[model samples]
Target: MAAKLIEGDPQRLGDYRLAGRLGAGRRGVVYEAYDSGGRRVAVKVPHGDSELWRPLAGEVAAIRAAAPYCTARVIDADCAGARPYVVSEYVAGPSLRGAGRTLAGPDLLHLAAALATALTALHEAGIVHRDLTPDNVLLGPDGPRVVGFGPVSPTETTLTWPRLAMSAPAYTAPEAFTGREYGPAADVFAWGAVVFHAATGREAFEGSSLGTVMHRVLSVDPDLGPIPQPLRALVADALAKDPERRPTARDLLRDLVHADATVRLGAPCLAPDCLTHASPAACLPAACLAPSGGEAPRWAQEWTAERLTAEEVLGRRVCLADALLVARAPLTLDFLLAAGGAMAARLRTPCDDPGLGTVAEDAYVTLDPADRPFAPAMFLRLADGRGGPRGTRGTEERIAEAFGPLVVRAGDLARLADPALPYAWPRLAGWIEADRDARARLARDRLFWLALTTLLTLALVVALATRGGPV
Candidate 1:
């Protein structure tokens, strides 16, 4: 909602002229502004050195990283001076919280699918929303867009509005309170809570106090009776207390869109690949069905140059459900299936990693193609408890012990394209063994050098005494 700017608001931020106050949160104020081209945009200005939210620099970096997805694009940021600000495309619409009525059927499906898309992009960029409440999702004419993405630096504590509470207890994940490390799974948990709220028009864990709400989030499963059919299972999977048990956003997108068919992949008649025919029946491989009586001559068989280059095929926007139709290998199909599979189907048995419990074992089965390249880095990231130069590390490691093989074969270039193995095994191995703390080894080397130097000096003195020199 727009409101006339009052005295305290800054007149302008960078090239954007602040015309009115769009809204204000604990950490900063969002102002409706006009850019240099007179285009409308929303400029966010953080309070001066305030403890209420993440540092403005952190927020700016996160926004930049998440710009490619359906998120509000970051136009510019001014962190050169004391009062840092970030400007992004202004989405003119009510937040999901103010959308008025509870969503059901197609409406509910679209909401879930859209949020899942946005969350997938954010996770791919290694950015966690941390706060994905109804208020953060803007229901615009274009579609539902996720806003308010920020970075969480190591050593930084939680931040919130001074007037408001510390954090939204009902939306926060269980591990966040238990002192256990969390990553993308935490956002997935919050996504489920938002879905519950959007469908029921009430908090999943409502309580008069923060403690009550947090306890419910940690220990209780939300009452799924209010959520409608089809969606009930999807939402239930997301709301699971075990983060590993929850499906990834990409998984939710495939399920929600396929459940109702309300959302299209991109456009009709625009298949991402030639193999992605109009329907499942059309997509059946020629080898799947054989001639019953006679065989047709090879030349007599119809042939056409309809097949396009793999690059061109992959360039189009295909529906999530149709991805398998065009996939060339079983691993690709396996990746899409596991990516969109149900949470219950994904979880096998519980493992040790706090970020990914049983999901790790499941990863070994289907093989997380995207995660396979980063297993070594993920191992180090979890061990160090910090994100490094390779962007933020997510908890997608299949197994911590798997790093030994990777570290041992770090320099074997011939193993890279050995389709028998994963694509990036050597790099993964190198990153793991290379990132371990070297202080102990350096200390040992220094002690040995000191002892050698001392022995050499004593020998020189003894020789001088034996020779009856100037000493």
Candidate 2:
């Protein structure tokens, strides 16, 4: 419906005039409209249904509630009436569901870090996104922009929502399905699922049908085969059966930042001393730790204060003292989670280790990038363009498409499809889209890409390496 505009439509909502369609969601059909002041924005109007007003208002509220963190900004809203509307600053880049599937290694790592940072901000604000998934996250050129919130539970009113399947089976936290009133950890579970899907281009839970998937998510163990090491433990912990076993968004974010900076990422620091300080973590054999004063951001102070407690998802300790003391501020890794899924194993850009790095988090691997300096630049580029991955494989959609049919129950989706499930493609599409910026970052430095390409030529994952459009 978003692709085709109704002809001769007035295209005017309040002070805004519709120009084109940006996208669609549960509450309304968002159009690329201009507000009264002539600013380009996304104007969301109701789909002739009154039930959407409250949720739309709630989404606006969530955005405002978390705006101080700037996790993602929702400029304004008009949800006061029976049929509500919204006006938000447009995110011109791709969605996580679009790019994440294609981004690998460090590029994905950086992006995930940014997202984790944002998640920290959200948790600190006393708000929890019950619906955290790839489609809801926009991969803007600048960084990750999280969208849609305020509504605690997805309601069933229509079936055309943007990411229906993402909610029912693939992206939602387990508690959401079991009727448990969950908190921030629920979002974290979804976060891991998002990372899982992006890393392998497959679902963490697989089944031949909807019933089978429900059994898989509830009774079966998630297939963590595609997850890399440093991130494996983190992702597994996030998906813990007991919500208490999971890390609070804030804790998860902190651990992610420190862990990412300390080790090469595939390696986890088991030493209590190394794990405690935010300083570059020291694992035996090789050193992946960033400088002592790496993670120092304004947000770092928030996490740095002793008033807040930090704990790993699995009771494994993660501290941030030496690193903070060294920098006298937040470390660089603190900003990583702002990139989304940085703490997860979804990204594998540094491919220096050859064999997908190593097996265990503490297990070490060797990286001999033909051109070491060029690697970081490649990651930054991929981060920028990794909004939507217009990848070469067309058959992959079958996997994504399978979700709508996979876990759907009769009344469950029919009632919640509007506010819950909604439409198809966009949700998963956003996370799976290739983050071109990440690739372009490498591409612009053609020499660097050339060097990395040479190295990738020997990699088994090379089969998974394919170019996407320049979206």
Candidate 3:
């Protein structure tokens, strides 16, 4: 809803003319504006002067980088002017918070798919919508368009005058309360919460106060009875308190759109080129090779593109090691499943370097338990055949020479396991260790050189004094 311009509001900002007030938040007032070409736009003006415009300026790059899919496109910005503001395409519809109707069936499915697609685009652009509440989602004629991408203010409130406060607290992931930096997984959690609200007309986690709401998010399991099958399972996975356990937005999109039509690949045989062979049994395990006209094992039928938990993969009795061996180049979903399985089993890959085990374990200690599952896939994806400046290198060499330093520089395990990227688990632990040792050795060498130089300089000074002046 747009409100008439009140007294003291600016009539114009740069090329855009302010028409009315769209909304107000801790950041500043958002205005319904029109560009010189008469195109409708939303202008966000910060509360403070130029010093406070940094975040708004940074947001332009982030929004621009994101694919224009289910999101408002950034039109222009004037961060250097007396009154800095950002102008984006004005979405012509009510926010999800203000849409006074419950979503079900096709409507609920559309909302879920759109939101997931928006998140997948954002994550691919290396942007995390730290604040993904109902109010941030505008239901336009095209679809649900996600807006309000910027730094999250601690004092920001969900309450907006006349509009009812929805499930803002419930949308926040558990890790946010524990002081961990928000990641793509957190957005997925919010997606689940938003979808839950759309389907059931209530917040998954509810309480009388902010503290109570946070407590529930951290500990209590939300009642998923209202949500329908497949979706209920997906929502439950998204709402997992452990961030690592949460399905990525990409994973959600794939599941929502292709739940029934997913392609199922039977377990691959031991041969390296089994996938390329003519016979279906070429890729199938010896036991899985059905007798004349007989159906394959129930376990082989279960291997679909659908997202499965580590426990589910193991329960199917599939061999993760065999899966990894036969996985085609440029890793596929099958590889990701095997990686997750490897993480759950704590399967140690054979490494000649005896110290590698200790190093990997040390690096693993730095990660939260939730982050451990993706390390192995992360390692394989990063180290697979790719190598040094001159040529390709071995796995151990790539780990020490290339992958290790990258992990140390990132300083966050979450980045390695990002849902949009390929998955990994244990190998990253080892890489982190190797990287640290290399850095430590370099530091020691520098220190020794400095000590030697200091001693030589002192001896020269003593020799000069003993020679008593001159020649």
Candidate 4:
């Protein structure tokens, strides 16, 4: 519910007239306003001369590009004005946190799916909702609508002090605490926490102090006893300490929708008479061949045979012998690798190419001689400038035709990788270990202070008794 606007509040901004205050935060106040057409909208007016207005404008622009199914549509914005403001479709309902009851059965499922769908749209548009919490989700009449979409500094302190001094510690990912850049994976972690709270009516991680909450988030596995099956497993995966192990938003949506087995990848036809000249594999989509089967599609089997034959032939070539073939976009390669079912060995390239003596033991060799540092190796180049695969089919179809076995071998690996992590973990481990030690030291210091305070209180009582009442 919106509170009546008070003194000093702007009644009008641009073409909209503010009616009441929706909420207020460090960034600014959100007012319930109406546009020239009298359409109710939520207007966020940043505090005077805030640097955040620029970034907020950028965020609004990015969000405007996203699908509006489960998100509040951005109506308008004016960052260049004396009083910059952003107007969005006003979601008139209580936040998920204010729902006041634990969601169960279909309600819980609906919430999860809706949130995932919203995230998929944002991620597809290359936007990460860094502040996805229960409070940020509005339980609209239509359904759950994810609202706030922008960056929130993890280190920012709140007036709430010991309880929530650090920004949403329970919902924040482990990587965020280690000073690693927050990505879409962090939002997934928050999604897990949010869903867990909705299901159980308690935070996935809870602590009396910020330090304790941070420790739990960084090192402790969340208890999934209260959450029901399937969702429990999904939430657990989302809350994995390692961000790389978490599923993409699209993967989450697919699982929730139970569409993995039925969804088919369609390939575009090169020509009307493509069937006469090229093999059926060149025209038909592989997913259509074995839509519901446990067995790999015929095209996938053929692609596997082709890939093996190519690899064997390439093995004879001295320069290509040890290199892993990319064959598709770097995102496809990452999806296959992270799926953890790919047959190809992981390679690293500290140097430009293996041809140079400075190359690491496991390095990539691309068909394109242009030196690309740490670029994934390509095998059967999907794109050959003519009216063949690249011209006729999409990347997914081409990848399926070329690395079909690898794709079918790792079924879920076909999903495009958005918000992909860099292929390196040596430093990640060190960062986690160091953060753990620092947290441990902080815990010890807190305990020492607690013990010291208790001892001092005891000593004071004893001395006061010995010295009599008034001393």
Best-performing candidate as measured by lDDT: 3
Q: State in Å the error of residue 331, model 3.
A: 11
Question: Model 4, 346-365: lDDT tens per residue?
Answer: 11112111111112112323
User: Model 1, stretches more than 4 Å misplaced?
Assistant: 48-62, 152-165, 257-471
Q: What digit string (tens of lDDT, one per residue) describes model 1 on residues 229-270? A: 668898889888888899987777655544533133322332
lDDT per residue for candidate 3 within 1-471, as digits (tens), equals 467678888978887667668888645688877654545678888665565565456656777867776778878887767787878888877788887667765466667777877787788777778668788888775567888775333333232311212336778888777766578998999999998888877888889988788889999988988787667899999999999999998788656543311112333223434433333235655655568678865544454333344345445655543333233343344333333322212211122221222334465566655544544544544444332222222333333333342333232221221211121224443555576688799999999999999999888888988999642
Higher lDDT: candidate 2 or 4? 4
The C-alpha lDDT values of all candidates are 0.59, 0.50, 0.62, 0.59
Residue 83 CA displacement from its true place in model 2, Å: 2.6
Cα error, candidate 4, residue 195 (Å): 0.4
Candidate 1 at 242: error in angstroms? 2.3
Q: Candidate 1 lDDT (Cα, whole model)? A: 0.59
Q: Arrange candidates by TM-score, descending.
A: 1, 2, 3, 4
- Judged by whole-model lDDT over C-alpha atoms, candidate 2 comes out at 0.50
- Worst ten-residue run, lDDT, model 3? 414-423
Rank order (by lDDT, best first):
3, 4, 1, 2
Let me know the TM-score candidate 3 reaches against the reference structure: 0.53
Candidate 2, position 101, lDDT: 54
C-alpha RMSD in Å of predicted model 1 compared with the true structure? 22.6
